[model samples]
Structure formats: C-alpha cells, structure tokens
Target: MYAYGIDLGTTYSCMARADQDGNIEIIKNIEGKNITPSVVEFISPTEIVVGETAKGDAILAPDNVVLYIKRSMGKQDENREHHGQTFTPEQISAFILKKLISDAEQMTGEKVSDVVITVPAYFGFDERQATENAGKIAGLNVLGIVNEPTAAAIAYGAQQKSKEDKVVLVYDLGGGTFDVTVAEIVGDKVTVVSTEGNHTLGGKDWDAELMSYFVAQFCEKTGVTADEIYEDGDVLNELILKTEDAKKELTSKNSSSFTLSMGRGKRAKLEVTVEKFDEITRHHLMSTLELTKIALKQAATKTSSKGKSCDQFDEIIFVGGSTRMRQVKEAMKKEFGVDPQVFEPDEAVARGAALLAHFLSTDQPQQTTGLGEGQSAADERFSEVTSKSYGVEAQIGNSMMLSHVILKNDAIPCSNTETYGTLAHNQRRVNIVVYESNIMEENTELSFGKRIADGQLDLPAGLPARSPIDVTFSLDRNGMLNITAVERFNGSKCNIIVKTEGLSESEVMTLQAQTSVIKVSDGA
Candidate 1:
C-alpha cells in the first residue's frame, strides 16, 4: 500500500499521493504551507525530527542541521566529521529520510515501507548510490531514485496527453542547489534526456546575502553590529527566519518590512526593496541560465528530430521555490524570448516522484527484480531488468555532481569505461568505483561486484602525477554493474575488481531487523 510521494528538497520537503484511478494530489505539513522546511533535527542520535519544528532549531546546531545534503552523494570516507560521528553526506541524508518517513507515518497514520526519492538531473553515480543508501539506512524499500527535473516533468507532463512528444526544460532551483534538466516526456514515461547544474548554489545563498544586507543596515541605522547582537543562537535563528520571510514577501510586493527578534527584548525593524535584492543576486540567477544552456546542448543528442538544438524546447517549466522571484522570471523571459511557465514549483517535484513511484511499482516492476540477493513474489515480474548505475561526485575545484550514466532513461544492462591517471611520476595503481549518474563531485568508487576492496590502489612510487588509467562499468539487463579499474606499477598493472550480489530474503530481513513499517493507506 503506497501512501504518498515525498520530495526531500534542499530547503523544503513535501509529500503527495495518487488515487487508484491515477489522479495525484499533494499533502500539506502541519505548517499550513504546501511545502515543509527541509531541515531535519535530532532529539537524539537514534531519533530525529523533520519539517517545520526542526527548522526552528537550525541555529542551535547548524552542523547537525542537514539541509541540501541531497544535491550529490559521494563516499563516506570522503565525508566530513561532525561532532563525534563521521558522517558522509549520504548518512546525513539518511537521517533526513528517516525523519520524512517517520513524520509521514505520524501524519497519515499509515505504514510506509517503500518510497520513490527524487534527485537532481545532473546527479552522478556516487550521489545516486548515496541517496539509495540513505533510503536503506532509513529502512525504506526505495521504489526508485529519480531526477528532480524529471520528476517535475512527470507531474507537468501528466497534463500533456498528446501523442506528440514534447521537450521541456525544467529549471529547478531549490533552497541550496540548482538543477536544469531537459526531458522528452511522452505518456507515462518522462525521459530525462540530459541534465546539468551546481549543487553548491541555491535560494539559501541568495537569502544569506539578504541577511548580510539586513545586518549592515542595522549597523548603520542603530549603530549595532552583528558581532554585538548576533552571537546569540536564538537571535541568529530568528534573523534567518525573518530574512527568509522578507525574501518571500518581495515576491508579491515592491518592498517588505520585518522586525527581527534577537533576544533580551531587542528588535530591529527592517524594510527592503526587491530591486536591492535583485542587484545582489543577479549573478546567481544567471548561473541558472548557463546551466540551462548546457542542459539544452546535452539534450540535443536525444532531440535530433524536428530541427533540434534549443529550438526543441516547446516549454520551459519552472519548479522549486527560487523560481518565484520576479527578477528570476524576468531574466528567464528576457533571455529565452519566451515566458517561462511556472507550475507549483514547491509541490510538483514530490508529486512527480509519487507518480514515478506508482509507475515503477507497477509499470516496470520487471526492471527492479533481483536488485538485491533475491526477488520478492511481488517483484518477480521485473526480474528481467538488471543493475543500477552508481553516481559519485568529487570536488575537483568547483563542487559538481557528475554522472557516468543515469537511471530509467539510459540503456539498461550496458557497460562503459572512463579513464583516469596517476598523479606521481612512478606511481602505478589508483582507486576507482563504478558509480551511476552524470555528476562528478564525490568519490563513491565501488559496486557490489565491483569495489576495489574498499581501499585505494597501491601504486609503485616515482611516476609522473596524473597517469593514464581505465575505469570500466559493465551492466546487465537487471541493471547491475561490474566496475573494474586497472592500475600501473611501472609499465602496466592489474585490474581492480568490485564484487557483490543481491540481498537475499534473509539479507533483506537482516538489514531490516529493527522494526517493520508499511504504507497501507491511500497516501497523502
């Protein structure tokens, strides 16, 4: 029993559900807002809190505050250590997933076991796998992890019943990340032809600038510097919330006013103009345009028909909260020569994910069979499709989410290789993992059957830095991949092999030993 779809976003998260007849609808959080703040808090390490309540406590523990962790998932070893526990971005994300699932169960009083998670279109193999692992940690039977832009297209494309295929540019800017996905959506299938974006930039960054502006104004108007009154966590948290409100207020009004409650009965009245906000954030908005251009170019390979190129875009759909800014809308209109069509940006992604969940749970159950050690009776229908691509994001210089290949849209059961090299003069071996997706920031360099034994390649010394190396990815019809990397000691070396298998029923049960939960109601 599937209850609803959850869009775990950078700044906000939401849930939705579809009826047996196939109609879809979104679920509102207790806040009365269609979108829920993506902040996840912890009552304890083993227990967590999500949505509005958690957002209230962000300043108290900013590092523990998991937001925008979904943009790209890499390796645990490469992740940062917060407090005492070393958390890979994926583990933090898993905590968020746990929060979402737990909140969903409490809200609907339904038992939810499986879910369809959403990611950015440009998420790489490491990132995608990291998201999957998050679901596993949360004890969820992930139906599928889909691209956020594709998810938006799915919700938007559902409105298009025409037999004629349509290409849409989903310009998705969430609180902490930006994603531009070009999809050829037809019928029930929303194919993510290509995707691009920056994981480090989003609406939150813009809001930070606003906070800075507010702080500066206060120093001038009241002669109080941030260092004087901003040290208090509560004061800072209140400021963050107020700034966000002002940002939203600017969407409808030319100027907005707010009084931030710092502490000790201290309050500051601030009024800001939309023009000022735009002046500060224009470059970030332009980045979206650049990402869109790249996505359009990458999608061109799939849009070779009907005089392709950017002309193939019949519609530019805007999703995510950042699209609400009038400046952003104007920029898009002026640049594209066409007005962008704005949907329920905050709600569409989750709704689309829910729909995809429904489809994958039924339409292509055959694609998900044998994903683990064994197949369930309900999953036997999809036993033919094998393997899922892994995505790893690495920070070369800028933070980027690179994909080797993505899910649902790419050809299944295929193999491909990307070559790398050693960095030292006489160095030989290098560590490599076979990840899924098109992002390139994190290093999740192993597969169940393709890990280089959880360590880096032992290279012989004295080689020039950055030598040639081959990383190969082989997939079967089941969508499983066997990743291998070859390293050189002097002239040539041996290949790195990643080995593993599916989760048998015993293994699945073992992994889920804690408790049993299910989505038995007609979801949100």
Candidate 2:
C-alpha cells in the first residue's frame, strides 16, 4: 500500500517513496545503489538486462545495448529489431521501469503500484504521453507525470523551516535534456511561473564533444581515419563509456585520462584537462545559460504586476546530476549575482515526487493553509503552466496559418475557444488539424509548428460557405489537451483528446502482454 515516485532520467533512473514518518527516502536498487543507469541489454529473445550490468555489457555487445532511449521517446520510427522482434522506444524504456519497480518491491517487501513519474518541464505532448505509456507497459499505475523542476521545487519547499514565500529558479541539466523553470513557493503550495528548455540538450552532448576530441586525438596517434574508427562499433562504444567516465572525473579533478585500444596493438592514451573540457564544450554550457535567460525573462513578464524583477529571486536551485559539473556552477555565479543552491543534484526530483505521491494518494491538506482554502488537495498543493502554445490550422487570406487557441505559459486547467468559418459551400466535413509550437505569436505560418493531432467535424449536407464552427482547446492540470469542435448551426460536435505520435491503445496492450512474459534481470 505504498505510493512511489520515479525519476526516469536519460542516463540514470531512481525510485523513492515517503516512509510512515512522512519523510521522503530514496529506495535502493538490487545493487543497494540509490540510482540505476537507464541502460537495457537484450541478451536473448526471452531475457533482458537493465541498469549497471547492462551498461557494462554495452562495450562488448554494442549492438544489443540501448542507452539514451529517453531521447527517442515518441519517435514513430525509432525501433530496434532483436531476435526477429521489434522493440519501440516505449518498450525499451519499459525494461528500465520494470527494473526500478521490481528492485523497489523486493527491498520494501511491499507492492509498488501507484507512482508519479518526473519529466522535463518543457517536454511536449508526445514525449509526455510516451513516458506515461512506458509506465503503463511496466504494469504500474502512473498517477501523474510531474515536471522535474517542479518536483525539485516541492522538495526544496518542504525542506525549508521558513514559511516565507520565495521565488526560485531551477536549472535542470540531465543526461539527455535540459529545462529551466521559475516558480513561486508559498509555504506548502508550489506554483510554476515560467519554464523553458531544449529536449535534446544535456550532459550527453558534453560527453559527445569530449568523445569527438578523443577520436580526433586517437586518429592522430594511431594513423586511422575517423570513419574507420566509427565503423568498428565495439571500439566506438568503449570510447563512449570511457569518455563518460572521464567527464565525471573532470567534474572533481583538474584532469582525467583514459586509454582506448583498437586491435593490432593500436592503443592511445588521451588526457583532458578540466579547462580544456570546458573550452571544447563551451557552446553547450552557453546554450543552457541562454535558455535560463529566456526563462528569467518570462518570469519577469509574468510577475511584473507584482513589481518583481527577474533578479529578485529568493534563491536559485540546481537539479540533475549534470549540474555537478564545475563549469555549471561557475557559469551560474558569473551570470547571476547570487550563489546558486545545488539541492540533491541527482535525487531531488524523485524525492519531491515521493512527497507529491503521498499528498496525491492521501489527499493531504496544505501545511500552512496558504492556497488550499477551498480547492481539492491536489490543486492546493501544486500548479503548473503550459510550456508550449497549442493551435489549429486555419485558412487566413491566401495562406494556411496556425491560429493559436492556447498560448504558452497559460496556467493549466484552462480552456479557450475560437470560431472559424467553413472554407467552401457544401463542405461535408471540416478538418481540424491541431498544432503545437514554442512560438507565442498568433496566426503564424503553419511551418512554425508541428502537427500533434487531427480530427474532422461532420456538417449537414448542402451547408453554405462561411458557416460558423467553434473550436475549443482545453488543457487539464496534468497538461493533457482535449479539443472539441461544434457547429453552431446544428450543434454537431466532434471531441478529441489530443493524440500524439505514439503507440495506440491496442498497441500498448499488446506490448504490455508481450513484455509481461519476458524476464528482466539486473546486471551484476
């Protein structure tokens, strides 16, 4: 009867739960470690391995290892063929989730069913949905998908003995994605102000920069072409593992070195100084700072009514294991005058999510009686804003335009409606194509955004042109989008829950069934 929280990260994952005393505790994996690597290895058609052991086996059997699968979530074409069977990103991710859940269940001697999973704040609809699907495939009840930064804020707010309201900025740079969020914490209630990020940016990118440098150096010393080195998957994977280790080392020491060996006695020892590492990957660090600036700007705009400036934050919090890099802290100090607080760089999200899961399952009231006056316990505890704008395609003048129905940064549990006229007489149906964009401008070119879902509303036959059709977009507290189209003339309506690019209901059920029988083991 324990509710848990999982931080299903890009390179590593962890699970946590609130104990009987209401203190959040990190649940150790079978290896007695707090975090597990998000790597999966398909050893056979019937057996799979996840975590540390799988990560180690990756260098030997590079083709069988799937790492950084978080980057491929919601991709329709990203799949691996093993033993004549196809495994999608969600399927691969399910193995990791299974490992986490199984390990937790074993250690706690209690069933772990209901859980809250954390994702990057800026993750789009498809990525979020795909994450939830992964949870379902793992045979767990996913209560909700909480944003990583928001979770961190909750953890931070809970730890504070002060009841003072504070505005906190969270910079989260994980293994495969980056997110910067600004939130206002009042006692026990956490309200997100603004969030910005790049789903493809993170610590792995830094590792890639170092790997490229290592490859170039090895080529110079061993007289081998880069393509030839890449063609040998084993050697490349070894380099990847070594490069990651070296990156972690550079975070603590001034320099780190690793030796890479290709066959035929071709071996080279490469060394990277911390300064050199920062120099090579400066752009990646700069990209995060740029996004942080955007997030701060957004926060300022949202809080301008209160006469608060972006720099007036009470504290700056850093989350994610990647934030352990020395360069990250130094950059934050140089950009903002305040010293940034690093709160459980690796475990804060899961810890906060554990607290949230407890609140959700028990419907606990707020501690300080701040915002939980009349609303449900969940609403009184947390609030978030939409990270992207949602719109429907419409014909305006001579060009097809995206008419935004919901603007970015709008508070969740919000709805908006727009009216459009039929394009042609006797139009049997009106096609509604929904689009999502990071851009905030209205009536932008359709190319500015990507299509998320589409549905059609049937109209009476022989309908004249310019008939009014109302399109409404509603976003729930969990960030799920639902669209409804109604014809004012006959009250004909079409309702669609925004379906993104991912597996269908039957597909998820099928994969769940297939995975239920497969044995998943933790790597030693």
Candidate 3:
C-alpha cells in the first residue's frame, strides 16, 4: 500500500514515495540526483533513452533527441515524426515518464502503483488529460492531478510557520508554459484563488531571446551575418543551447562566457547583464502582470462578497523556477503592490503533491497550511466546501438568472446557482449558451473559445426561464465543467459534455504496450 507523487515538468521530472510513516522523500536518479531532466532520445527507432543518457546523445544525435516534450503536450498540433513513426507529443512524454517510473521503483525497492502528478494551473482539459494518459502508459494509477501552483503553495506555506491566511501568487514560467496562480493559505489547507497563463510562453522563449543576442555578439566579433551563420540549422541550435546556459548563469553572475567552434568565425564573449536581460524579457514579464490584474479583480470581488478584505493578503508568495529572475519579482511587486515571496520554486509543487499522496493513501492527513483535518470554521477565508464559485453572480437576462462558474480565492470547488425567469409567456423551446465573462469595474466582457481571456461553449437548453430556472455550474476537482439546468415548471433537464483534450485513442493504446509497467498484487 505505497503511494508515489511525480512532478512531470517541462524541463525536469522528479519522483517521491510515501512510506508507512507518512513521510515523503524524493527518489534520486542513478546520478544521485533528485531532479532528472525531462529529455528523451531515440536510439534505433524502437529503443529510447532518457535523462543523462539522452543528454549525452544531444550533440551527436541532435535530430533524434527530444527535450522539453512536456511543453508541447497541450499544443494543438503535437504530431511529431521521427524515423518514419508518427509520435504524438503525449507518446514522447510518456517515454520520459516511463523512464522516471522505472528508475524510482529501483530506488524505492518496492512496487509502485498509485501516483499523484502535477500540472500547470493554466493547462486546459486536453493537456491535463494527455499527461494522465502518459502516466497510464507508464503503468501507474494516477490518484489525482494537482495544479503545480497550488501544490507549490502548500509546500511553501508549510515551510512558513504562519497562521495567517494570505494570498500568494505563483509565477510559474517553465520550459514551455507560463502560469500565474494566486492561492490563499490558511492553516494546512491551501486553495487556489485565481489562475491565468499562456501555454506558449516559457523559458524556451528566453532561450530564443538570448540566441538573438548571441547572434549579435558573434557577428560583432566575426563579421559574419545572420544569413551566413543561421543558414545552417545545426549552428542555430548550437547557439541557442549555449545562450540558454549563459542566461541561467547570469542569474548570479553579471556575465558568462561561451565558445563557438564554427569553421566560419572566432569565439566571442557575450557580456550579459541583469539590466540587459530584463530589457529583453520585459514584455513577457509585463504580460504576466496583465493576467495578475484579471486574477486579482476576480479574487477581489470574491473576497469582497465573502466579506474578506483584499488587504489581508499582504505577502505575495511565489513558487516556480522561473521566478528566479529579478525582473519577474519586480513585475509581481509592481502589479500586485506587494513584495513577491518566492520559496521552493523547483521542488515545492512536487513536495506538496507528495504530502497529498500520503493523505490519499492513508487517513493521517495533517493540515500543513494551518488547516487541520476537518472542515473550516466561519472566516472570510472560504470555509469548508459547502457551495463554491469563481465568477460573480449576475443576471443573464432581465428576468433570468445565471451563475458564471469560476473559483473564488478562498473557496475550493463550489457552485453558485443562478435563477432565471421566463422571457415570455408559454415559451417552450429555449437556447442556453454558456458564456464566461470577465468583469472590470462596470464592464462585463464575453469570453468565447480562445478569443476571450477564458471562454467556453454552448450548454444545453432547458425550458425558457419560465418560473425561476436554476442553472448550476459545477467545477470538479479536475478543473472541468459540468452544467445542470432545471426548468422552474417540471424540472426539465439538458446535459452536455465539453470535448476534453488529451491523447487520441490510437496513440494511447499504442503506448500502453511499449513501456515497462509494474503491476501490484491486488490481494495485498
């Protein structure tokens, strides 16, 4: 009866196990490392290598090696071909997960079956489900998919022995995605207040940004033009990785050195400064602020209606490796009007998920965020999950009522019912298209598809708001949507399913056989 927690991240992956004592310790890889780089390389079309081995083949087998596949998971067109075999992003990622699972089992000396994996808060249905399929391919039963930000909040809040309920914003700019989550921590319970991000933005973007700088430096020293150097894809790839290393090193040092062995030119020193780096990354950092403003306004209204002042959240806690940048911290401070608090950026989410793993496996659930075992008492910070919501309660029509389903800052997954009234006399046929709207001051904007900030599709129609129609939007633990509309007359109903995003049927089935999986003895 053992449980495992895996943080399947864009740049790296880590695993941990919950022992009989309810303790969670990370399982180090063969290199005696707790974090294994999420990289995979194809050997002979059928064979795959991961982590150090994969990195070893990067220079030699550049075309065959794939790194940061997790970033490509939630993408619209993730179909990649290697050696004439079509591999969806999910299948490639599953290979990385499989490698981690096999290595962890060796370290734990036991059969591992159940797992709790981490995902970005901004990951839509397709990406989250895709990660789950990857886990299935590795043969581990996923207990839950926890948001990476919320998990980091839990781990960070536990590390801070504070009893005060505060709003901590997690700025997670990983290898492929950027997610900003504001969480409220009270006692041991940590709840995600609001979240926003773009899946396309991440550290990889920074790598490209630095590559441009590298090109400038190389051209300045060697008198080589972009057309001459970048014409070769291999040279561009080589410079991109070199610049990525320089960017990471500039975290502490003012400048870093890079050597190029191209037949065209001599090596040059790229004098990198924090100010210059921020100058390049300013726009990207500012974008997160816009998202934070939206999240804050929602959180503000949520706290206001609940009678909790937004001022209570004095310290803005951060959890993400990308928060290491000084510019991001400044951006957060300028946006939220508070000093950003960053603790345990890399391991916090996984650590929190591991704690949750123990709670799910065994009953000894310890409240790490000042929230003890049971439900919560009466406080502005949302009390036990009675009825929860994220969006504001507003009128859809003159007489009809509708609830915009959104999670509150302090509230967990709760639904608020909107009562609708009859538009006309004897109106039988009706159309109910669920629209997600973001409110700013008195302005309310409709969200549809990717057009708006976060838009949704049309829900089934019940009887026209004849007699108070009640539409309940339920958000399950998986961040998915469910709608139930009952007509005021005889409770006539309409139900529909939103298309969930993930790996296709054939891709998942094909991957099920390739990975080595450990099957647990059910009797024990």
Candidate 4:
C-alpha cells in the first residue's frame, strides 16, 4: 500500500518514501548505504549483481560490467550480447531497478508496487518512454516520471517555511548528465519557467579528463606506451577505478596521489593538486555555465513583460552528487553574485519524488505535517514546459523541411495540428516522420534536428497531389507524445503513439519474462 520514489541516476540510484507521519526517509540497500552504485555485473547466464559489489568487480572483469548505461537509454542499436542472449539498455536498467526494489521491500517490510521515478528535465520523448518501460519490466506500477531538477525544487520548496514567492535556478550536474532549470515557486506550487541541458555531459567527463592525465603521466614515467595500456582492458579499468578515487580525494584536500603498478614490477606514482584538476577541466565547467546562461535568458523572457535582464533570479540551488565538487561551487559563486545553496545534493530528487508519490497514492486530500493548513500535499500543483521542439517532415515547394508542431518551452498538456499536402500525384501513402530539436527556430532544414519516429499513413487509392492531411501532435502532462494523422477528404485517420526507441512491445514482454526468472542479487 506504500508508494515510493526512485532516483534512477546515471552513476548511482536511490529510493525513498514518505512515512505515515509524512516524514521522508531514504531507503538503504542491503549494504546499509543510502545510495547504490549504478553498476551491474553478469556473473553467470542467469545471475547478475548490482551496486557496490558489482562496481568493485568492474576492475577484475571489465567486459562483464555495464557502466554508464543511462547514456544509451534511447539508442536502438546499443545493446550487450552475453552467452547467446542479447540485452538492450532497458533490460540492463531493469536489473538495477529490480535490485533496488528487492532491497527496499526487505528493509521496509512493505510491498513496493506503485512508484514515481525521476529523469532529466531535458530528456526527449524516446528516453522518457524507455525509462517507463524499464520500470514496467521491473514489475512495478509506475505512477509517474518526474523531472530531476523539478523534483529537487519540490523537495526544497516543501522544507521552506516562508510563503513568499521566489524564482529559483537549479543547476544539476550528475554522473552522466547536466540540467539547468529556472522555476517559480508560489506557496506549494512549483512552476518550471525554462530548462536547458546536455544529456551527454556530466561528472564522468571530469573523470575521463583525470584518467587521461594519469595515463599520460604513467606512460611518460614507466615507459609504457598508451596503446599498450589501452589495449589491456583489465589494466585500463584498474586505472579508471583509481582515477575516480583520486578525483574524490582532490575534492576534500589540496592534493592527492596514487600509484599504478606497471607490469614487470614497475610502479608509476602520480600526484594531482586541486588547482591542477580545475585547470584541466575548465572547459567542461564552462559548458555548464553557458547552458545556465541560456536557461536564465529564457526564464527572464517568460517571467517579465518589460524585457528584464537575466539577473532577476531570486536564488540559486545546486542538485546532483556531482555538484559536490568544490570547483563547481567556486565557479557558481564567481559567475553569479549570489552564493549558491546546496539542497540535499544526493537525496533531494528521490525525496521530492517520494512526496509526489505519496500525494498520488492517497485517494483523499491529506495534509503534511510541515506545511501549514489549507496546503494539502495532494493539492500542490506542478507546471512543466517542453524541453524540445517537435515537428514533422514536410515537402514545402521544392525542398523538404521540418514543420514545427510544438515549440520548446511551451507549457505541458499542449497540442498543435498542422495541415500539409501529398508530394506526388495519386500518392498511395504519406510518410510521417517526427523530429525533435533543441534549436529554437521553426521550419528549418531536416538536418538541423534528428528524426525520432516515423510511420506510413495509407491514403485512399487515386488520391491527387496537394490533398490535405492533418497531422496533430499532442503532449501529455509528463511530456509523452501522441500523434494522429487525418485525411480531410475521407476522414480516415491513423493514430500512432510515437514508439519508444529502446524496444518493441513483444521485445519488452520477452525481456520481462526473462528478467522475472533471473536472480538479481546485491553486490554485498
């Protein structure tokens, strides 16, 4: 009967839930930790290990470990083949979810079924659908999928005693992605103004920079060629593991060092200072700053009629475990005059999601202990905006172009219908290709954006060219997409629920059966 919130992160995952008294608590894994490493190791054909234990075995069996799988969520061709069985990103992610749910059920003694998961605000429809599919494959009823930055804001807003309105900027830099969002909080409601991010950018890039530096230094000192080390998976993975540790040490101290044992009883000792670390990774930090600037400008335009400057943000908050780096904090302070506040850098998203899950599960309006009366947790409203522009490919005059149906930053639960004509005389069918783009311009060349979904709409035989066809794009509250094509002449229609890039229906069901029988165990 309890609903839980899960932050299925790129490098780590955490789950939490609101108790009967409305107190949010992070559910710890069997290893007695609030967070579990997002690592999975296939020990046998039917056995898999998740979390810290799996992460530890990564150095020993690099080929068997799956790391940073989040980056491949929506990629159709990205998969792993083990022991004559193929596994997609969604299936691999399901194992992680199953591991977390199994541990959570044991700790709370509650049957965990309905739950809300969090994703990056800038995730496209394909990625979002893939995440939901993963949850389904794990045998959990997914109540909803909340955005990471918005979830963090909800958790922060609930903790505030003030009723005054504030404009908050959330900078989320996680292990595999970064999102910068601007939101307006009024009373208990959190309304997102604008969000911008790169799903491929995050703390792992920082780790890569450090790892490259270590490899170079080691090669120079030990006379070990970079190619020789790179070709050796075990050695490369061991160095990568050490590089991550060194990065953590530099976070709290001025300097840190590690020694790598080269073959033939030779060891290369390396040292990295915090200053040197920052110097090497300055570009990555600047990339985030630039995205923040874009988000701020968009927010200012949306919130003000008089064209106010982007500095109108009342406060800035940092989320995501990667934000724990000292360099990130220092850069924020130097760029923006206001000091950035850290709100539960590791657990805020899951905590906020837990609050939402509780509200969604309750049938009647219930009051939380912290918020004042008349503020029912169930009644709190959340408004989200679209992260990317959605369009369909069309033939305009002589050249093909993308006709936009939904612009980026448009409010949720929005829909748009555009009419187009067939390209050839007596065309038997119309090709409908949906594309999504981060670019703001509309009616641009098809190359500017990537196609997400495509389908063929069969038209009545002998349909003349220039026949009108209505294409409608509808976005639900959670940003899932639905498309409908109608023939104005005959009223015939085609409904397509933009397919997920991860897997087909039959594929998911097959994987679900396979995952159900597999034994997913904790690394501990």
TM-score of each: 0.72, 0.96, 0.79, 0.93
lDDT of 3 at 520: 16
Better of 2 and 4 by lDDT: 2
Task: Tell me the tens digit of each residue's lDDT in model 4 across 1-524.
Answer: 77999999999999999865558999999889999999999988899999998898988988889999999988878989876678888999999999999999999898899999999988998888899889989988988888899889988887888856788899999999999999877877888889999999999999999889988998889888899889888889998888889988887999989888867876889889999899999999999999999998787677532244434877899999889889999999989988999998889999988988888777554433354555444446577889999999987668898889898888776889889888778888888899998877768899988898887888888888889999999997677889999988888788878878647878778889998988999855
Candidate 1 lands at a TM-score of 0.72
Q: Which runs of model 1 end up more than 4 angstroms from their true locations?
A: 28-34, 44-47, 58-92, 106-109, 161-163, 261-267, 301-307, 363-413, 417-471, 475-481, 485-524
lDDT of 3 at 299: 59
Regions of model 4 farther than 4 Å from truth: 19-22, 304-311, 365-379, 422-428, 458-467
Q: Could you tell me the lDDT of residue 213 within candidate 1?
A: 91
Model 2 misses residue 497 by how many Å? 1.6
Using TM-score, give the best candidate's number. Answer: 2
Q: Which stretches of candidate 3 lie over 4 Å from their true place?
A: 19-22, 162-166, 265-269, 302-308, 330-341, 363-410, 416-447, 450-471, 485-493, 499-507, 514-524
Clashing pairs in 4: none
Candidate 1, poorest ten consecutive residues by summed lDDT: 378-387
Candidate 2: which pairs clash?
A: none
In candidate 2 the C-alpha lDDT for residue 113 amounts to 91
At residue 124, candidate 3 shows an lDDT of 59
